[model samples]
Target: MLKKNTQHEKVSHRKPVVLMSMGAQERKGHDYQVMTVKYIKPLAEHAGCVPLLAPTCCGSEDIEQYLSMVDGVYLTGAGSNIDPALYGQENLTPDKQQDPNRDNFDIPLIHAALKMGLPIFAICRGMQELNVALGGDLHQKLYAEPNMLDHREDGDESVDEQYADAHQVRLVSNSWLSKLLEAEEIPVNSLHGQSIKTLGAGVQVLAHAEDGAIEAIHLPEVEQFTLGVQWHPEWKAAQNPNSIKIFAAFGDACRLQVQARS
Candidate 1:
């Protein structure tokens, strides 16, 4: 038997764990919490992190605990729209889908995550949640707003077609996204009806669509990585260089958090 050379082998570093907020859904008669594989794949493959789905159907009391268990937070897009009342507006789109349990849980979770300085990557509806959580408002019906382009995905299109590049978003000069993508502008997919109407207290615009809708944002004041995009970067992320950059940056930030805790 050979003796183990433990002295020469370095201890392996653990991958960062990301707490991902999930959507509330109903299948048949029972209500359930769900998270799509699309969101999980990039976090695991590109970000090199363990994906932990946090159920928003549950109460928000565990947000602090959830924060303690992970190095980063991921807020994924959902099929439902946020309740307009959150930003002090009446429910103008009452006919649109809404998930009250998810709304109640995720808002407090975003607050808690920010308070802890945890890196957050919010997408689509997740971006809206982050905005509302920070005192910003959204255009309940973006297309309805004069001069704004329709950003919603075509309902009858296949998944791949819907996630295909819809338009170009001009990156803010010298912003983090522009630096990462190494370009002034890039093509992006669009699949949302609401968009930022007012900038959040500390949220800085990172990119914009041709029609002037906010395409990307980040907290310039935050030390940790904080980003939100109106597009679904997680869709076919491995195949997109821009999406790869976004996930890679987020992964690096998460790993740094792991090192800090160690």
Candidate 2:
């Protein structure tokens, strides 16, 4: 059983806690909520921080308790679209896979983390949520947009296998993302249908696709490191130099957050 820890433990002795989102599980037989711990752990450890598996299915008691204990948050990629209700639209197409439970969990968490100015690294769906939570919008379907290539390849969505690099994103000059990557443009694997349409308040566009789709975002006003990218850096970080640099930068940010608390 996952018990909620009530107190905020000592900071100096604490590990740098990263709150990652988890998915709903299927029951094998007995009562157990099975969820796979995805991207953040191995990559985080490589960057020198401990990763905590923070599930979105937890009750309010668990959510509040865990958020209070963590040092930082990592909003990971999701397979479903952000509920259209979140952006004041009705569900145009039904996606049964959507998890309202997880959506509800993350919305408030994003706001709370922003309020506290915690360092946040959002990838793919996480990036989209950050924008929506800040009053921005998303392109419901990328391929529908004129001149936009298929953002996601047909028939295969998983990132574990070898795939062709579909497109390149041009980083804005002198932008935080460009500086971090030290490059003008980079090849990225696109596996998302929804993307940033209008950037949120205080959020700056850091990178864009050749088709003008928003690829990366940052909040310059926020003191802490807050960035969102459209690609899955965790999967590509193993071999791609640019992806590796991006993760290394995030890890560095996590380290700094850990140091400040200590």
Candidate 3:
């Protein structure tokens, strides 16, 4: 009988590669595409995945190529807002920062990624982008709306305080998100001036704030894990059970994609 060398035998398990969309920034006479460390850390720590940054400074002509190499897509919150023109709306907040380059790249990227059945987790501005890509419009100034609560964080507060839990969001009964988190309501940080005014096609509301602002959404049409949240769950995700579960779920879906491809 031959003795099996179990110690020397190696089994390989590939980590899912998530294509993280970058925001365009210009500084010191140079143009740069960047994503915050806050968003990146959670994917590496909680999600158990590799992060691949996709540049939006350059147009998304090569989006298909970028998608081909990754198992999932992660759209993160950005300092800039999406261009209103994409969703048939005139420039309502022209003074606010808008990234047309990112707009051009992410919209097509969203459509193509969906076509390829990639799991997507979008946050803040990314959520707005997803809504616009799906034919939805934003309030532009959510605080200005009648009876709407102001969702923006005070600029004077420290970063940690700004990202702290600001309000509670009521999760829809029998929602996938509610089931995953095992909670009917969860406290979330609020730091945006705009909110979804009109829902996009196939977009289903998952959670809402006390003021009725849409806090989270999901696409029921996509069999893969597709979720968009207005809050910044990536901020100190390890400290929060809800954030950990959300990222872990996304990571699991990406791993399944990796398995399918293999």
- Point out where model 2 deviates above 4 Å: 1-15, 25-38, 156-163
Against the correct fold, how does model 2 do in TM-score? 0.86
Candidate 1 per-residue lDDT, tens place, 1-262, comes to 1334452232126789999988778889998889999999999999999998888766888889989999999999999999989998998788988998889998999888888989999999999899999999999999999999999999999989999999999999988689899999999998999999998799889999999999899988878899999999999999999899999999999988887886
* Total backbone collisions, model 3: 0
* lDDT string, candidate 3, 116-235, tens digits: 999999999988888888999999899999999999999999999999999999999988899999999999999999999999999989999999999999899889899999999999
**Ten residues in sequence with the least summed lDDT for candidate 2:** 1-10
Better of 1 and 2 by TM-score: 1
Instruction: State the lDDT of candidate 2 residue by residue for 29-105, as single tens digits.
Output: 64333333447644564455677677666644466667676667788886678888888877765853576777787
Off by over 4 Å in 1: 1-12
Candidate 2: residue pairs that collide:
none
How do the predictions measure up, each by TM-score? 0.95, 0.86, 0.95
Best by lDDT: 3
- What is the C-alpha local distance difference test score of candidate 1? 0.90
